[model samples]
Target: MNVLLLLLILSFASTIQCDIHTNRIEDTLSTEANDTNTLCKDHLQVPEKVRIDLYYESLCPYCKQFYVKELAPVVQKLMNYIELYTYPFGHAQMKKNDNKTTFECQHGPTECYGNGLHACAIQYLPKMSEYVPFNTCLMEKWSTDKDAEQCGQRLHLNAEPIRTCANSDEAINLVIYYAQETEKLKNMSYVPYTVINHKVMDPETDLIDSVCATFEKPPQECKK
Candidate 1:
């Protein structure tokens, strides 16, 4: 009897934990929007550092690796000097099939559950004051589970509304818009095309070096 009771308790705890994680991201994102004291102010006043807009697909491994391991941390450090934006390559298609209980990799959009959701996260900006935390939570939870709803709960978000928002046209359209605008910004035909202050650069070579040199003050400065 005790063992059965313990198992039930554990299952309940796990469910609760997932819900918390999912909602925490949204809550954090809301806070980020109002806390203007941070370095991510739009139309930045500073001039010395370059303005960067990154056009990327979440499915792209390079973008995932760069962002998870390198880019996000760099941005956090140089938040004052840089402006960042993200666009997913598969945003439009994802929305068309978002209500799906299971992903359709053969005919339907592939990123319906992946990068598509991240783009949806952008909608909370400037009003909810929780965009950053929500985004961070999403990124952190990436790959663990394909379902954003599950991930959102794990992030400690207000899971009730996020679940509703997850299935809405509003979320889908927002992601699509993010993709379309990103394509316009840099003519981005590739998954991880990076534009630094109007200068287009490659992530594997040029962008990586620039990000490192500018943010970390590399030991050997290239002439460029």
Candidate 2:
């Protein structure tokens, strides 16, 4: 009886181990096989150490427009010389839409509800780090049409985690840290401020002109 019990326990443990191993292999294979590209408006040809930090809230229509109309084109032209980063502000606390108390669709272009989708985006950053083109697509969808479900599905993201993060103090503070630290390091006094090669640029002129001049390969670039 004792021998039988021991044998049964060993068998169960072995089965569990096998199952775990199989699942892990499947996960790895799935991830490895995924080769999707992310689409961003600004596809900067970034050189190492030349980083750009853009601060804006997801709900801010102005930010969305700037990204689509200006930043995306500039980045695409200067892809070899610019590295882009994001800082989200304003709707950090997941304020619900006035009409939809449970979850509000605040803007037409973005697919967010001031809820978990935002948090989920941050949480899943690890899985998404490699997919640059998708980030652009997600942002583009959110900017033009506020369909959180469609946007999430478009990016292959889960909604639950994003909502959870939007309400989380830790997540808020983390985003805050990124914004504040960026401001401090780059001596930024405003949002949409671009730091290029240690110079603080006005979002309107300096940043735009700098990117253009770099692509134009002008020996003497205009300083805005």
Candidate 3:
């Protein structure tokens, strides 16, 4: 009789222990699931993009160098993190004579035409992914009509729309709009003027470093 009683006690204790162990395991799993959910939410949050404004003319050598050498290469890597605005009018004056408007560029008539091409590209492309490469190619050489068409072809883009736009009054209007935006900068006396988040960036500073400094959480490319 005593043996049977002891056996019963042992069985009861074992069942209680098993239940406690199972409860602990469930609690542990619940805690782990909550932690995973929290981590996922943090990981999925999007970061704010940096704003960059470039004021330059098509024919300026310094502007061309900056666009082709510095800006274009880094743009693709940082595209996700940047909002780029390009203004192609630099020291270009607009004069209206008896319902006809004429422009005189600092670099002369050829430059005015080149600036129109740039404005047209921006108007037609509208996306940095498309326009940046096209502009980079154009800036690397003389921005002639043939050069524009060639760049468009090299990028696998249809050049007809861009060509049509360049010859239209719409292109002139776009250039005029850029000229107005350029005029807003206080005491601006230079081409290739770069603004990062509304502040003028120093020309001597490394472009990447200057851009990375503005980010609250710099990207992986910035680390490299």
Candidate 4:
């Protein structure tokens, strides 16, 4: 009877040990699962965007080429990783005579008008997504009130406000604001002056490569 009782006790002890082992395995698996979830959350966090500034004149052929051929083609891909700012005053002189402010553009009066149109568009369409396409259309075709209206209609944006702004003092002030921003760069001598992350980018360098270099964790578009 003692031997049988001893076997039964041993079996019971074994069952208890199995239960403990199972509980430990379940607890360990739960901890590992929680840790995995935490890791995934960290991995999925959004990263900061790189900043890009383009300082160019509206009538500059090089600016138009850059905007139409180079930047516009890949802008959508980079939008996920970049914050773009465009300054429409380049080599444009603002003079104050007897409290009257006058401006002169390198190209001509037409260039000044083009710059004003761009400034007004930027003022009305604060978002890059909205203004970039409009400006791209302007640069590709021409920078005129008619062109602005056509681009606005193509983009399904209201052109009246932008046209009114362009003809008013608001556009002039916006150009002045951009002039102030552009003057911040000392020894600036050319159109299509590009800055990435507050640093001047060499004109020879590929824009996409320069932009991709700024990211810590580049987006999928950068991989291409």
- TM-score of each candidate structure, all chains considered together: 0.55, 0.47, 0.79, 0.79
Tens-place lDDT digits, model 2, residues 75-130:
65555545566555433323336642232233432423332334335555644232
Alpha-carbon RMSD to native, per candidate: 16.7, 15.3, 15.3, 15.1
* Global local distance difference test of model 2: 0.47
lDDT of each: 0.52, 0.47, 0.82, 0.82
lDDT of 1 by residue, 62-167 (tens): 6666566666665555554555666655223322345542333211354454554565565544322244445555555552234455655665555445445556
Candidates 1 and 3 compared: the better one by TM-score is 3
Model 1 lDDT at residue 8? 100
Name model 1 segments beyond 4 Å from true. Answer: 1-49, 90-110, 125-133, 136-156, 185-187, 206-208, 211-224
Q: List the residue pairs that clash in candidate 3.
A: none
How accurate locally is residue 121 in candidate 3, as Cα lDDT from 0 to 100?
Answer: 89
lDDT of 3 by residue, 116-204 (tens): 88898898898899999998999988888899889988999987787788888988888888888988998678878899978899998
What's the residue-level lDDT of 139 in candidate 3? Answer: 97
